[model samples]
Target: MSEQYEYVPHRLLRHRVRDIASGVEGELMAVVNENVSESGVEHWKELAYIRNASGREFTTAVANVVPT
Candidate 1:
């Protein structure tokens, strides 16, 4: 018999910035290509993206398993 793996969704998670001073927020994605951050934080990834009224884009910092 062949074994099958249960499907999981990354969008169920919310990624937020570690430093509040950065003024970032949580976001959702269909998938996370990378599981590590540039500074190296465990169980976190930068997949969320944001933008201002000016239409400027900013990359998210981290992810939360549960909504905050």
Candidate 2:
């Protein structure tokens, strides 16, 4: 007999700041949601809002798996 496995979902948001002169990047924030998972195995999805020094904001989303 085959054992059934449960799937879990997770959400995380990460931020980074870039230094133009030094060409270095630094992490600003990391947001995690514990209630996003149904089981121990975590599946992650990310959404990012990036602001540039010129005051321009860019948004992006990343997913672990694509659903059809």
Candidate 3:
């Protein structure tokens, strides 16, 4: 008998910064929001509220499985 594996959707926060002087852009930060179990079940809720240096508030919600 063959075993089947299930795929679950994961979510993450990807942030990037842009340099106006050099015209360069790259990823600045990445945060994992959720983690899925071996059975492809999400065990936690992904919710984060962040504030930037510019006083900008950003909220993100993701439901995914990630390694801790």
Candidate 4:
């Protein structure tokens, strides 16, 4: 069996990004590590913050975006 690892979004920060799902382009502003609780289980996730040309800021999963 192969080993599995957690995904980290840090490297994607400060780069231009395009959302795979929405097709929106923007600059990656930050990657935030968040602790989430679900059904009494704790989990850590990385969220990417982005700013578009219109000056709108939004947060999304790193998997949803790619460097453009």
User: What do the candidate models score in CA lDDT, each in turn?
Assistant: 0.39, 0.36, 0.38, 0.76
On residues 24-60, what C-alpha lDDT tens digit does candidate 2 reach at each position? Answer: 3443233222223346665544433334456565433
* Candidate 4 per-residue C-alpha lDDT over 1-68 given as tens digits, one digit per residue, 9 for 90 to 100: 22223435567677899988788899998776666656767677777778999999987887898989
Sort by lDDT, best first: what order? 4, 1, 3, 2
What is candidate 3's lDDT per residue for 1-68, written digit by digit as tens?
A: 12232223324234554333333344323333444345665465343433345656443442221222
Residue lDDT tens for model 1, 1-68: 12222223554434432224364344433333344434444344444344434545454443423343
Q: Which candidate number would show the highest TM-score if scored against the true structure?
A: 4
Instruction: Rank candidates, TM-score, best first.
Output: 4, 1, 2, 3
RMSD of each: 8.8, 12.8, 12.6, 6.5
Model 1 misplaced stretches (Cα beyond 4 Å): 1-21, 24-32, 35-44, 64-68
TM-scores for every predicted model: 0.31, 0.26, 0.23, 0.70
State in Å the error of residue 35, model 4.
1.6
